[model samples]
Every structure is written in C-alpha cells, then in structure tokens.
Target chain A: MVRWEPGTAERLQKVALELFATRGYEQTTAAEIAQAVGLTERTFFRHFSDKREVLFQGQELLVQAFLDGIEAAPEDASPFEVVACALRSAATFFPDERRPHSRTRQSVIDRNPALQEREHHKLTTLATTVATALRARGVDDVAATLAAESGATVFGIAFTRWLREERSLADIAAEVLAELLTLAARALRPAR
Target chain B: MVRWEPGTAERLQKVALELFATRGYEQTTAAEIAQAVGLTERTFFRHFSDKREVLFQGQELLVQAFLDGIEAAPEDASPFEVVACALRSAATFFPDERRPHSRTRQSVIDRNPALQEREHHKLTTLATTVATALRARGVDDVAATLAAESGATVFGIAFTRWLREERSLADIAAEVLAELLTLAARALRPAR
Candidate 1:
C-alpha cells in the first residue's frame, strides 16, 4: 500500500496539467504524469482515476459551495436570487491565481471532443444539483429547473468571459445574471 | 450508387427506434436495424452514419425552423421575442403523432451515457444557432447569448414536460417561457 502523502493529489494535478498543456492531452500518459510527480502509477490511481480527472477534481467542492449557498440564503429569496447567490458563492472556489490554469485547461478541453462532452456533462450535473437544492427550498419543478439551468448558463458565460477578461468571477457572474434579467424583462414585455 | 428510395430513412429510423426500445440500445446493432427494415447495411449507411444518427435526424429540420422563424419575425421584434417565436415555430416539428416516438427516443437516450452526451451537444448546437440568428438580427453578443441560452433552457423544460403531460407543445413552451419571465421579474426585484 502507498504511504499517505499530504500534497500528492495537488502535485500530481499540477504536473499532469503542465504535461497536458505542453505535450497535449492525447500525447500524455498516466505513467508519465505519475513519474513527473515522482510517484508510482498505483499512487496516481489512488488519487485520480485517470489523467482527465485532474481537471475535474474541483467539481465536488464547487457543487457543495453552491448547495450550501442556496440552503443558507434568506427563506424569502426568489428562485433566481437563490440561484444567483449559489453561483456567486461557488465563484469563490476559483481564485484569480487559478485563472491561468483554467485557461490552459479550457484550451485543452476545447481541442478534444471527449473532453468537451465531459465538460457538457459536468455542467448538466451541476444544473441538476442546483435544481435539487432548489426543490429542497420549496421551489416547484419548473421553477427549480428554470432557475438552476439559468444559473448554470450565467455561470458558464461568466466563466468564459472571466477566463479572457480581468474581472473577478463574482462580478462577472453578477453582471451576467443582471443581463439575463434584463433580457427576460424585455422578453416578458407585451407585444407592441 | 444506391438508388434514391422514398421513405427509406424514415423506415430505418422507425425500425431502429423500435429495436432500441424493445431490445435495448446497446443490444440493438446497426445491422439488426438495417435487417429489420428489409434493407441492406449499405442502404442504412446511406441514410445515417451510425445507429445514433437515427435518433438525431430531426435536429437539422428543427434548427432550420428556428432560423427561419427568427429571420421571419417582424423587424422590430426583440431578441427574446425572436427566440420565443422561433421556439414556438419549432413546436410544429413535434406534432402530437411524434410524441410516442420522442418518448421512446428519450428513454433510450437517458439510459445511455453516450446518447446523453450527444443530446447535450445537440442542445448546445441549438443554442449557438439561435445566438447566431439573434446576432444576425442586430442583437448584441451578450444579450443574444442570454436570449439564445434562455430559449434553449425553456425548450428543454417544455419539451420534457410535453413528453409526459397532455398539453400541446406550444402551450407548454409558452407557459415555461412565461414562468421564466416571472422568475426573472421576482429576482430582479430589490431584496426586502
């Protein structure tokens, strides 16, 4: 059995991401990632199932943040407000220091169809998690789904822009949420 | 070259879906689908690249309907109005007669990860297409994306319910859109 290591996972993720960025995700192998971090292949498997999982390690933490934020919001909060708050809370998971890594990770994902599909699936899961959280908050099915999906959309748009622009994730998310609300207002206006 | 055959693609899709529903998607093979339709495998290849394409054949027509609806909307229509109109127009693509087929298709897709990923990709493509149409109508990027993504979200919610509920697709879609607008309104209101 491999001995317990404090930063093994983080070290592995860093080395794997660098390798993926330099040599391409397809060109990189799990053994190379493990060796780069001075760990055995078995040790790498103990931390991550595969090389692709390094980029997705934070998904669970992000989901927890979203759920906690939603559950902690005021009882009177609107569905959209709860969603917005949850997204804003989740934004804390991605520090500005991680932006460069995120940009590289996204570039890698964009080049690979499998990664793109995984990313889409991740987003879908995130939306479903948020929807479930909303339902727990007494929101109905349609409203919960709408709010959760809308929040996920706002998060995606903001995350994309945030990767390219010099803005805080929270600010970007807030701006996108407001923009969506404005569009929704315009759409709701009675036909002239 | 294989001679053009009337309704061959439809017949193949019908057989493929039936086989998928009864025998399971993974258990159903392309050869089996072709054989069931009384056609050679080569003939099946002429219509669909693979078994999955049989389920996604309507995507193109739906996209076209969305584009056409956006293009034909009154020049003064808002981005959201154009999207709402486009979705309403696309509803005609899913006539009542097609509901049973769609239900079966969705069940097959839900049980398979690959099919689910394809469905998500298809939705993403639909959103992108709607965004492009809105941009062509002089809508700004951010607003167009918001409207387009929102429209896709509404379509997903409405379509899911329409599959299980007795209401017409158009009515369900309109109601979901209205519900989203209402949620947006409440979220836009200042916190008490």
Candidate 2:
C-alpha cells in the first residue's frame, strides 16, 4: 500500500487555491504555487499532476464518499432513500470548516470557462458513478439513472448554497433533496 | 433579416462528420472539411466558427425548440407537463431521418474527450435554458431547476436509445419521461 502523505496534498491544495484566486488561475504557475507553500516545484508535482489538478484534488474521495453512502444505505431502502442517504453521507466531506475553502475554489472555477466545463464533466461522471452503484443494487436501468442524476443535481445545488450559507452541508443537502422530491411530486400531479 | 444559405450548413456538417469519423478528428481540418463540401474555407468559416462547431451545429435550434415547447404548453400546465411538452417539441429536431447522421456525429464525439466535454457543456447549457424558460412561466426556482434537469436527462437517455432503436425520438422521450416520473414516485414512497 502506498503510504499516504496526509497534510501535504491538502496544504498544497489550499495554497494553490489562494494563489489562483488572488493572481488569477491563468497567471499562477505550479512553481509559484509550490513556492507559496514553502515547497519545491518537484514536491508540488508529487502531490498534484498539474495546476488544474490542485483545484480538483480530493474529487476521488468525494466520489468514494457518495459510493460509500450508497453502500451504507439499508438493504431494503427505496431508491430515493438510498440516494438521500448517499447525499447526506457525501455532505460529511464538506463540513462547516471547509466552507471558506470551497467558496474560494468555486470562485476560481467560475471565472474560467474551461474550469467550469471541467466541473460539469466531473458532476456528469459523479452521476454516472452513482447510477452504476444503484444498478449494482438491483435498480432498473432507467430508474437508477433518473435517481442518480437527480441526486447529483440536488447535491450540486446544495453544495453551492452551503458555500454561502451558515448551515451545515448535510442540512442543506437534506433540505434540497426534500425540495426536489416535492417539486417532482408537484410536476407529476395532473393538470386541472 | 439576412438571407439564409439553405443546405450549406447541413452539407458542411455531414462532410465534416464523415471526415472526422474516418480520418480522425485531430487529423481533419476546417479547410479540408470545406474542400470536401466543395466550398471555400471562408464559406466554411461563415457556417461554423471552428471545426468542432460542425458536430454541434443546430444546438441553438434545439435549445429554441425546447424553449418553444415550454411556451406552447397550457398556461396552467404543471412543471412536469411543461417539461414533457418541451421534450416532445425538441424531439422533432431529431427525426428518424436524422438518426444516422446523429449516430455518426456521436461516434466521432465519443472518440474525442474534448468533444465529449463540449457535449456535456452543451447539455448543461440546455438545462439552464430550459430552467430559465420555466422560471419565466412562473415556476419556482428549485422546481424549475429540477424539472428542467430531469427533462434534460430524459432527453439524453432517449436520444441515445433513438440512435439504436427503431422508435421515433418523440415516442422514446415521452416514454422515458414517464419512466422517470414512475421512478421518482417509487423512490418517494414510504419503505414497507
């Protein structure tokens, strides 16, 4: 097993986001980011593959959290229940302590169209992953896809709100999921 | 109003997809695509801003179809009803006659990560456009977002099926939307 360097990656990510935010993502270099954290350029490369990777670090862990959430749900849980569990579980990855960091990271991503596209791609991948997990649990293909994609949409909206609001990420995600369910129900109602 | 050059854009897109498929997207150039269509590079530039644009031509029309669908729905239609109407309207843009062309275009996009990212971005934009249209019709913010996103997901899955199945895009999208609603209801049900 690879010995994980715990704080190094997190430190590099935090420093990189700060530099990217202040100097502009395009203006900042890997070397400059590494220097800001008192690390050598080579040390920075050891933690991240590229400058963009810094902003996207921990994505795998986030995806895994969603998957783990799926795994942790009750075996007899409804598809929506499974998804709700997953969202609540994934929200643990972004506690109150991470709000400022997330906000800065989002700000950096928003200014760059390329980064925004990358973020979109990531969310699409997350939805696909969640759908596959549901399928593994015996959910039908279309149903699994709809639930997973809806879950992704809920998570995304909630995450954005969490960055700006005082509420915890878990609380925000739960409320968002409830709102989504309510909206879906309202839409499904027959027109008078 | 500017006089439209009929058949030019469609013809260029066809030739470009063929070249991108057989010759590889990276190997083909805008000039070559134009030449294959018996047009000058300037004319090609007039049709598309870049080589990648050839595969994505008519996206604006597709978005417009969705918006028009929203507008065509009854003023008192539920959010889901509005989305369903929009999806059906958008399906008219992907008739059976266009499936082979769409398949070829999608195949070419599948092989290129950059093109895939562009497609994701386009879908995101479509959802946002649909949501805004719903909001204009007085749908609540989260309801509009959920309905629009669900509509986009239904469209995407149905479009994939349309490429391979004998069913019309409209039929497939309507069925898919129905399936999604059913899934959402199932998930929302209290666990036994």
Best by lDDT: 1
Candidate 1: clashing pairs of residues = none
What tens-digit string does per-residue lDDT give for candidate 1 at B20-129?
98899999888899999788999899989988899887688888878887888899988878887888888887877779988999999999988987887888999999
Worst 10 residues of 2 chain A by lDDT: A1-10
TM-score, chain B, each candidate? 0.94, 0.94
- Give every collision pair in model 2: none
User: Candidate 2 at B150: error in angstroms?
Assistant: 1.2
C-alpha RMSD over true interface residues, each candidate: 0.8, 1.6
RMSD of each: 3.9, 3.0
CA-based DockQ, model 2: 0.65
lDDT of 2 by residue, B1-192 (tens): 112245989788878889989999999999999999789999999989998888887788899889889999999888888998999889888778778888898999899988887897788899999999999999988778888888999998898889989999999999988887776677778768
Docking class of 2: medium
> Chain A TM-score of model 1 versus the true structure?
0.95
- Residue A42, model 2, lDDT: 98
